[model samples]
Target: MILARVEGSVVATKKNAKMTGNKFLLVRPLVIDSPTAKEWKPGTSTLVVTDSLGAGEGEIVLIVQGSSARLAADDKDSPVDAVVIGIVDTVDVGKHILFKAQ
Candidate 1:
């Protein structure tokens, strides 16, 4: 599981058969205020994450384990390794509002 933003969509003319009908999203890692980790790969490369979280452009989301993701997407045979599970509109860390979805 990681924190990433949807950079854009992906189109595969030829792909795995199980991947058909599944929306493939290109993601860039996000950088939050972290004392330990200072930088993030915002656009270095893109990951193909399943859109189980219903995340739109620029919306921050929560990604989870592939097993859990398989359940979320209702695709037991999906070979996806990464899955976006939640569309986070707001995040509260004690007295801080970390993010607002859109």
Candidate 2:
């Protein structure tokens, strides 16, 4: 799993039959400055992920890829390469608290 922020969403009126009702989100992966740092920085690239947990824009989320993503989706056979698996609450790295949800 990887930490990411939901930057926006994707609307696809026409898609695969298995993905008819699925929601898609645009997310940027979050990376820590350092092991001892308490800050999270946005990754350079963005990704579109399937969402079933109703995650909104600006929320930090957890994402899974490949076969794991398929398992996280409502339909296991959906052609999903990435999926939002969880909405992050807090991120604690050792003694430093990296993030907290409001």
Candidate 3:
């Protein structure tokens, strides 16, 4: 699983039958924070993640990658990589607040 933020959505008319009803989101994978980091950059690749947590654009979400994404939907045959498994309500790291959702 990875921490990512929903950037947009994808609409595909020609997709697997099981994927028809699922919401697909474009996300940017967040870089793991380092205590002594001077620079941090998010991944350039945009991932298509199935939205199970009802996430929206600009919403910070928890994404489950690999075959586990299919398992989360209970469709082992579904072809999916990244999936929005949880909507991040708030991120509290000591005295830092990274992301928050209302």
Candidate 4:
């Protein structure tokens, strides 16, 4: 799974039949500054991911990519290459709390 922050949304009126009602979100992958640091650093690229978890903008989410993306969707044969599988409530590294949803 990849750690990402939902930056925005995507709208598509016409798409594949297998993806008719799915919502898509713009996500920026996040990486921790270090193992001990509580800060999350943004990755260089962003991805349009199918939102399986109803994650809103600014919320941190977990993304599953490649063939696993289809597994996270309602349709087993979806064309999605990436998917937002879960919304993160909190991220704790040992005694340090890296992030907490509000």
Against the hidden reference, what TM-scores do the models get? 0.73, 0.94, 0.83, 0.91
Candidate 4: give its CA RMSD in angstroms: 1.3
Order the candidates by TM-score, highest first: 2, 4, 3, 1
Count of residue pairs whose backbone atoms collide, per candidate: 1, 0, 0, 0
Which sequence of candidate numbers ranks them by lDDT, best first?
2, 4, 3, 1
Model 4 per-residue lDDT tens digits across residues 4-64:
9999999999998888888989999998887667777999999999986679999999999
Give Cα-based local distance difference scores for all models. Answer: 0.71, 0.92, 0.79, 0.88
C-alpha lDDT (0 to 100) for residue 5 of candidate 3: 78
* Candidate topping TM-score: 2
What tens digits encode model 2's per-residue C-alpha lDDT throughout 26-76? Answer: 999998877567777999999999999999999999999999999878567
Candidate 1 residues 30-65, lDDT tens each? 655565343334646567787844677777667765
Q: What lDDT does model 1 reach?
A: 0.71
Higher-ranked by lDDT: 3 or 4: 4
Q: Choose 1 or 4, whichever is better by TM-score.
A: 4
In candidate 2, how many Å is residue 84 off? Answer: 0.9
Leading candidate by lDDT: 2
**Runs in model 2 with CA error above 4 Å?**
none
**What would you estimate as the lDDT of candidate 2?**
0.92
